[model samples]
Target: MLPLAGERKNAKGIIFEKAYSRNISRGTSTLKRGFAHMLKNGVVMDVTTVEQAQIAEDAGAVSVMVLDKLPSDVRKAGGVARTASIRIIQEIMDSVTIPVMAKCRIGHVYEARVLQETDVDMIDESEVLTPADEHHHIWKWDFTTPVVNGARSLAEALRRIEEGAAMIRTKGEPGTGNVAEAVTHIKKVNDELRAIKAIYDSGDNQDLIRMAREFKVSYDIVEQTARLGRLPVVNFAAGGIATPADAAYLMSLGCDGIFVGSGIFNANDAKERARAIVLATTFWNEPEKVKEAQKMIDERQSMLGLDVNTLELRMQERGGSA
Candidate 1:
């Protein structure tokens, strides 16, 4: 095995090893997917500064996503959004012991390449940033670092996975601080998964093939997902997740993990909210524990949420068709 760096234990006592077999190679499908699996049932928070990254780490976040601006600030700023500064990404990586992730614009291969060269633990080909390519996303297989992409349906998720995305997240309307869209998305993916599972179970190969065509993914991958009854990769709930209840509710809906963007630092009680969301995500199955976590933050201190229907920019739709 080839040992890497940044080995650490999660709040659940899960030891994440930065090691992989040399024969399999560093960015092979198994190693990339395994990197995401290590973060299952944990929270990944977005932060623009080393201070916020440190807070996320101290709050038991599995990893911190470095961004040039918080999603809310991005929406308000309203210019072309790009990747965070390499210096800032490296600074945050140096500040924390946990793995660090940074975002690159969709379809911007060079941006992804730069992030990979920065040695970030992961790269998010995120819609939250202004997409550089309108009809094509970055071909993720070309990079040595694992990449994560967002999806609102099974088809999008499957297509990204087919393109070598190591992880998938729901493209909830980012910066809204509203969990409604995220809920709708995961439910839609679940509904589609159930439909495919039934088709696969009925011994209908023709129907499975047709479904694969409809999803725009390979038959083998569609069949694999149907047999498993879940995503082929770790699926996390993200965008506008503001409260402990929001985190717990999404977990109950069967997400492998949670991603908080702009929800923490935008709120009045960032430190408490960050820790509370992590606690709620970790103990989502237990109502009493979740309630304890919810009490840790005051609602009045939460980020001011925007109505999804009234938003001018629907970030979720950015790279859906691409």
Candidate 2:
């Protein structure tokens, strides 16, 4: 095993353990966190083909997530949605200089192994795809490649982080083209964080232990989160973001970045909307700039959005609430 720059190896240490353990050398884990940090305030577009991947790169996307089906199509078709074809993932990897990510069914270790071998920069243990293991998620520490997972609350986010997820995205009702669920999830996390922070400020270690037990995560992880006052890793907004305004709105809600899937290719103006969403996310704090991005596309030509309430399946709920 290759030793991380400052990581001293214990012969008995977990193989590849430097990848995620916060208790290990801070430098190693911080390096992984920094990779995601570089994409902060940027947009990560989902692409199915090399052409679309190139378009996303051209539009200033920080990264592109390669997937077999748009979440909406995954919902519409109603079958087991798996990882992208390796051929397509490789083609997209060849096509873009920016980071390339691909999704794996939740807990699908073999699929994730295949993606890691494909040399993709990141892996999303995505709920947008069908779940491969109902009771457990992949043990991400076993791999060298970084992983991102979805969460709806602080407890869920902390659990994924403990499981070695390098990043987190809200598991909003995907493919619906609605932002409400995303907003709700982010707020739920934020509210819980605030509560934990308050408990920390009160100097109540016992209360924190209670919280750790309640969240079913490590006490150290909860304590560290309270110390940082946010997720230790990057947190991005995803699922159902269909417009530039939707992207900016999530940024304002404190996500480090945004992930837009069906919102782009499924629309009438892929190029324009793609560019607009990138601009919106980057300048999310600037209201005037957001308005400019909002005006870049014709709303009539946007994807016919579905209401979250009307959807028969909520992709966000697939991973059993954690």
Candidate 3:
């Protein structure tokens, strides 16, 4: 459950204080980001139905994201994609003990508002759905529910954070079943972080300012990220991850967690695949354990991967700009 408004301590020992005690708003950055912190090193799986949500929970998913259609199905449908039904979100929330998340089209503030009112544990201003606005994204701080946004680079991630996004996920090409783009994104973020870290270590404020200007984000965030050597929020890997090896590879790349969409349900062995992914993600550092997880599902049962280079719709580009 989300922490209620007040100076209360959560189960993980994160203290949530009212940012504005006199105002009705309840979501402080501490509360929002702390919710994401609790999900680190776990898998967040996408499910369109209550049964699938149960399957994910049984398979050890830390949370379930409710969607109207899987990312692959949304790609094939080729029309305006929107938020999941309130009934379905409510049903899934009732069915699962773990946190429940739902997506709203990028920049759809009202959709986010509705999800918050529905008492969802988290809201994803996702690129998987057709974007509702092109020039802007929702100012997430206005809402009491935490928001997670996707980013392809450090600059984009910082922009989202500046707009009050509590968590960030790599904007890998969704529904493609190809992990290449996801790998590329995380690596790029890592490389950029290293660059900024080196600049900060050299104590070159001028160069840091230049880098911030180039990245098009605030200098404070850039410097803070440089000082910390990582994203301020939990950074998860999403999009085209189909195999246990794929999950483990992303984990090795320093992702805090994984978000599986269209990978498990699109395959022939959802239950087994889901469990395998969870196992691989949890024991990513142990090679033999990962190998055992790899053997749990047959390779032939995997989803047919799409070449991201040839995709007609590049979902990752949605809501990319500040």
Prediction 3 global C-alpha lDDT: 0.90
Using all chains and alpha carbons, the TM-scores for the candidates as numbered come to 0.93, 0.92, 0.92
lDDT of 2 by residue, 1-322 (tens): 2112212123211343355545454224455556788888989999998999999999999999999989888888898999999999998888789999999999999999999889888899999899999989997766667789999999998888877777889988888888899999999999999999999999999999999999998788888798767888889999889999999999998999999989999999999999999999989999999899999999998888888887788888877565
Best by lDDT: 3
Q: lDDT of each model, Cα atoms only?
A: 0.89, 0.86, 0.90
lDDT for model 1 comes to 0.89
What value does the lDDT take at residue 77 in candidate 1?
Answer: 99
Q: What does candidate 3's lDDT look like per residue over 71-108, in tens digits?
A: 99999999899999999999999999999999999999
Considering only N, C-alpha and C atoms within 3 Å, which residue pairs clash in candidate 2?
none
Off by over 4 Å in 3: 1-25
Q: Candidate 3, after superposition: displacement of residue 221 in Å?
A: 1.0
lDDT for residue 180 in candidate 1, whole number 0-100? 95
